[model samples]
Target: MKIQAKSLVDTVAERLEEAIIGGELAPGERVFEQVLAADYGISRGPLREAIRRLEGRRLLERTANKGVRVVDLSPERLEELLQVRESLEGMAARLAAGQIGDDEVGELRKLLETHQETSLEKGYYQQSGDFDFHFRIVQASGNGFLISLLTEDLYDLLRLYRYKSSTMVGRAEQALAEHHAIVDALAAHDPDAAEAAMRTHISNARTHARMALERAEAEAASTAEG
Candidate 1:
């Protein structure tokens, strides 16, 4: 019974994060604990625990009035985060190039093939599987601190922005090509090339994200005026 309840908390937390990433839960939206708990068909006790976990992840923040809101970093703040991401992920690629084993490189190749097939089926963008590519490389880096910082500290938040950017026209194919380049660099064990390729990929993603956000804001403004 205790284990089941714990499982329920984990399930709830996972779904909530998915909702946020999928844009079902808008950035800065207020969360209604009772309603959300009811929606999940769970008691408030478990739901509160789940929410607390997300809050700890820096995804949710609590207010003085017991209100919970998604963390909505402004454009400038998001840019700052992306800049840091650019550097860290580049470093990860460089390290991975230096140390990644043949088996792991082969596994990454398999992942890309899987991703390509997935893309063909879905017009080239699968939201659920998108984060897997970078994650595998970061793990291959073998740097515990970089792994912890990127995966634990910044993964989901960065995913949020990337999700927004990924839907842009032509971005899917472009990103896939970029992924291929990074993988090629890693396969060749060229640290300089790997770092350069990864940095370029991240930089391009930041540009796409900025454009997507601006379009969304403009659409919202138009709707408001109408």
Candidate 2:
């Protein structure tokens, strides 16, 4: 593939990744190269490249005997991911507190304001904006490596969970309040406070995820029993 051709693969990877994260391709869905090629108006070659990239990213898995499919994140994996997210986000908030100044802090505050406003309008729009609010905090840490690795990708994975979480009874308002606390800590330039706020925010999100998973499992069990 030429340099330009390689870039097309990269673009495919991103779009497909977003689609998976956004739940367009639900967990365990098989990837068909032909369908994807038709949808994206690309050739099989580029679609294959995209699949390979997703597999590398751990977003898709290829069974030894079967073809590639979207990863079905078990509850255990969700718990593990939540633990890691808490620690990483805490560090990000701490670093961002000192590394970023008032201007950037102000930007975050504005984002939160918009998030709250938009959230009241509709569930889906709120879900999308909430991601931007949290991601901007990660970017404000000024850690290029962490930002590059976690920014869109991690949040993409989290987007579905975030949507689910935010839609939970009273969680949308509660999450907005958590954002307020983190913003205050950042504005104060208090690293410890910022870290604590972020830790709490992620912890709450983890709890929400756990509850959601449990509810889903229970529903499935109830259906089976019926």
lDDT of 1 by residue, 1-226 (tens): 1223558889889888887877788778899998887778788998899899999888888999869998774678679989999999999999999999988888888877887877644334434333488888888889999999988898777777777778788888888889899989999999999999999999998998889888878887999999
RMSD of 1: 3.2
All candidates: CA RMSD in angstroms?
3.2, 4.6
Assess the local accuracy of residue 5 in candidate 2 as a C-alpha lDDT between 0 and 100: 49
**Tens-place lDDT digits, model 2, residues 53-130:** 878767888998779999875788888777877888899899999978888888887877777767744452333433
Q: What is the lDDT of residue 191 in candidate 2?
A: 98
Distance (Å) between predicted and true CA of 101, model 2?
Answer: 1.0
| Separate clash counts for every candidate | 0, 0
Global fold similarity of model 2 (TM-score) = 0.79
Give stretches of model 1 more than 4 Å off: 1-6, 120-131
Name the candidate that leads on TM-score.
Answer: 1
TM-score per model over all chains: 0.91, 0.79
